[model samples]
Target chain A: MSHPEQAPEGRRRPASPTRALAEPPTTRTPETTRWRICREVIIHRIDDEAVAYDPGAHEVLYLDADAFEVFKQVDGTRDDAAIFLELAQQHGETTDEVASRFAPVLAAMRRHGWIGRTHGADEVS
Target chain B: MSTASTIGGRDVGPALDGYNPARRASCPAAPGPESPTYYRIGAVTVCLHSADARFREPFHHLYQRHYIGGPTLSAVHIRVDRVIRARPLGRGFRICVDGEERFLLRKPQAVLPHVEWAINAAVAATLPRYHQLHAGVVARDGFALVLPAQPQCGKSTLTARLISRGWSYLSDEFALIDPDTLRLDPYPKALCIKEGSFEIVDAFCPTAGALPSYEKSWKGRVRLIDPQALRPHRTPWGVPVGMIAFPRYVARPAPALHPLSRARALFQLLDVCFTFGRYRAATLDVLGGVVERAACFQLESGEIDATCDVLEAAWRAHVPASGRPDPADLTRPEEPVRPGVEAA
Candidate 1:
């Protein structure tokens, strides 16, 4: 069995904010870990926002435009490192700022079991 | 109670929770002069049987407006009988619905509220189709405004003030939303006002003082107020939803009303919503459509008079001079919540 908490080689927690933008922190997510939205979730779109219902868990949550955007990015194609950089560029924020902002939302979705992660991005489909 | 008129079009059978459909011989009603009173409140019909006529007079006084002449097939049966099991001075009453015992009470004052509560349960059991909310609904000009109220939220007080000021009374307890029509039907049950507000209510409803009081457990002493006294001939009926306001009573000079996104509003509403007969998908659809068409708001309500003013203003802003049927009446929900948006 593999340990999920074990960080990959050389990806350690950065000491400062400036160093964070360059080497984001290893605590938030593993660099090789890619997330995929659980396929069983139901979504009802209302304008830019969406009310996502998890049938398996029987729970509902409101995903505002920003959260929805972050959700859309979790296509199992990109790791958290890539997503943070992309959202950072789009929102005009540093990678560290975007990562911190996106962390809680991802936590909530994972808590709802709406998304799952796979390491090394191997056979993600 | 008409078979054709049952809520959600579901037939009345064993669906009534805890209702024993055994022949009336099994659990006989208390032996006495039982007065069977049939009432139709919104889409549900209830037939209540009380042993003593004088004992149930207060109930008649409060629910006089919603009474119907004849009985129907789908009616839920409630039997409140004074049963003296052991003690004579503190006699007990066995309250039953369709031959199943619901509540056993000894206090004379507790009878009325418990009977009202048993009727409340029967109504929900009878109408398994609509999604019911613990809300106070009032209408103006034909459009309904829903007050999604939680306990101690002053919903009863606010609703009474609005109705007394000429707003049509829909209900003070249940907001019945038909899943098919996506419209709210009135369930204008009497306003169960806590003792704290008796003086204020008596100011507008003079008869409130004369009505007998019941010591409702946890709620303290309560008096049931007939909504008709608050607004005459404000007959209950179906109305299109215009806005849903979640009010929080706080000390303030004027109430503050803020817009809410449909997603957020619908989620909050579902938190307090009960699906009686039908289940989830329909609730999501019915409530979703309501949120999409209606303006959702969160209010910090102050004194009743000022709060009414703020609520009226909010409703008027969404409904134009054209009287809410115009295509423009379909007001869009506020923008999607930005990151870290604070709730008001």
Candidate 2:
């Protein structure tokens, strides 16, 4: 269990362009995580343009856009604390709040066999 | 009974989903006589709960909730337990049957045609490495034939005819391939015996089994000929694809076989595909692998007997003539998957 540095800008919320143009966020209820058989391996859009894959055991697990963004923030070069602060600044959320949200998403992804846990220099650094 | 439910973020009741008021002005529940019994396919699986029936032949009713009347002969009901948006074309419709998401479709509406298509799509999409073909696959004595034909080209009729003559019907519409082993996965189901072909079937097998024909489709009338009626001899797990035949039924007294270049056959198969543009890269990769290994032939048959003869001869030429060899002997290793390749 580790903590990230506080954002220098303190806890300013990010202004999401998606939030302004979109409908108000429905209650962010937790979706029951399920492993849908990968029909097509799409690393793209959420709509019909998504790709399908028939998963083999050797397949790399993938994340949806929301999940992948959380994953992209993880760099082996940075410690959890540094990574948290950078992502919080990028998304304009408090470091603590961003880490709290990131934890559950990572847990969900790991549970679904998307990504395996890795210990690297970035986390130690 | 278009019960209310939510689909694609819209409060789509049965009526809205079926009639699509924008697509059709009048919303008629279109009452038709219900069949006395509902036939269940796929060997009775747990997904029965999600199955929706579509009348394909001898009946006009598809399902109680979803009904689109076209001249149909056989009906298939599929309960789609999961509709995930996974394909690049946005049509990754998978149905849970046989304990696997065996079917995959690129256009959502394509699965709506018949339950068999939905199930077939799921099976085809999930197979390892090999191309999922847009053709009917039938086999006999461990030898399999992939028939890729354009609509009105008598592919189904040929399938029914061959199945009647001891060929095991893999599927009347789809052919699934597994790249890992180069085996043709069996998706045995009903054959879409066209109206004109019905007479040919009657003449050939005289005792041929067929469902009733619906007189409402653009193709005059169509019916389904059950594969089981032919008493298929083998339930072989999978077969190596041996030949690719593009067949057309023209009302000529004579039949002709045309040797098509692999390129020509590939384009022809792609052209007849319902969702090639949607599946794009995956579909291209799959088909490309298949065409490379199998010999391609075009059959112009004016008569049923002549068509069968041409097929038999072609089979003799491409398939091992010694008979009943292990499927593993004929298969070739699959080509490596290229990176970031989007099929045009």
Candidate 3:
């Protein structure tokens, strides 16, 4: 079947905390997973809608849907491969193409704290 | 840098005109035969004038180029330059509609596609002092449907469908909220139709105009259509927003309406707002008050009939079946965020 491919690194099923410890400490800090909008500010979590809170101005920025999804998949547990697979599945695209097309965007998102990944569950083994 | 006035307890300022030569050419401040375009959402008077008639072809088309879409209206106001078009009214703003009174904002030049952005940003810029929301408002049977979506989530598609089903198109891009009464100010302009969905709309309602495609967009080519000719009716001013629904155009077997949690609802409302940061405290307070009162839900559907039925039912159940809300206090929540990313 020509289904969307999983992120090249492979998909990690949601595992228990025990599996998390065996992996190397994840470097996916907040900064590594912020959603960038208009190439200006970085936002976190956008599963629903997104509002940006500016500390200096004591104000909030509203993000449209496109920016919302791009920011929602930044959890450290999900690798680039997983993110690509998920987006592909949602929009109907092949994973290989998505990965090739999304690498730079994901990297840019990482620099802004929009996505992150940790050592595999079997890294210690 | 003139003194300030008050409207519904909010301070006011003088009308500021743009300096761009192109803009000046389109909208000269010199008194012309054309009357000033003023919109009264409660008490706030948004006075806009443009020398160019091309910008006025379709009321909402201007919004397509700027923001997403929302509730909007086009009307004429007759007034002497001394009072209606005068400098800041020292303290009291003229009351043209209902109990609400708002300060005046006048822009002499026509700013295409960017008009909605300027209007919404201006309203949001005064946050904490006033409330503003980034949402689309459509109405049927005196009640309005508020659709707040992240980009490319078929917001414009659903809006176009609602118009076909006889709902008055309030605004397709964004809805501006008044801080005092928690009412929605009309930012009605154009509808932004993205690719993939563009074909869907063309099939659903071929009569709606789809401008030539725009290329290289992440969502593919988008067309801005003037729903005025296609719309069934004019959305009444101050149509009480009865239902707040999030539309997801998934090709599923059936359309379902899922209830949303207040926290999640609040989170989403924040996400869909136009300029939460710009409005600050007022935006938060108004939005919070609205979310507290309105019913929030997620709509999953591939079929328009199912979606419409579910939406209509939700509206009748929550809102009074007799008529819509007072025109000034139509409150809307934020659209759903994708995931992990909270709603604006």
**What DockQ does every candidate get?**
0.14, 0.01, 0.04
Off by over 4 Å in 3: A1-125, B1-130, B209-219, B251-253, B323-344
Stretches of candidate 1 off by over 4 Å are: A1-28, A89-94, A120-125, B1-32, B86-90, B276-278, B321-344
Cα lDDT tens digits, model 3, B125-187, are 442333445566787666567787766667777788777777887677666565666656554
| Backbone clashes, candidate 1 | 1
TM-score per candidate: 0.79, 0.46, 0.48
User: Candidate 2, B104: how far from true, in Å?
Assistant: 23
lDDT of 3 at B55: 34
- Fraction of native Cα contacts reproduced by each candidate: 0.16, 0.00, 0.06
Q: Write the per-residue lDDT of candidate 2 for residues B1-344, one digit (tens) a residue.
A: 12343433565223212322232223343233232233333221112323222222112122222233342333333445335564464634455444545455443333433345445555444433345556778876576788876567777877877877778767677665665655677655556666677777787665443334533234555554556655535545567767888877666789887765444455455555544433554554555556656666777877777778888877776677455433334322132111111121
User: What is candidate 1's TM-score against the reference?
Assistant: 0.79
| Model 1: DockQ vs. true structure | 0.14
The window of 10 residues in a row where model 1 chain A has the poorest summed lDDT is: A6-15
lDDT of all predictions, in order shown? 0.69, 0.49, 0.49
Q: Give the lDDT of residue B235 in candidate 3.
A: 46
Q: TM-score order of candidates, best first?
A: 1, 3, 2
Between candidates 1 and 2, which one is better according to TM-score? 1
Q: Residue B239 of candidate 1: its Cα lDDT?
A: 79
Regions more than 4 Å wrong, model 2? A1-125, B1-130, B209-211, B273-279, B282-285, B321-344
**Could you report the Cα RMSD, in angstroms, for every candidate shown?**
11.6, 20.2, 16.8
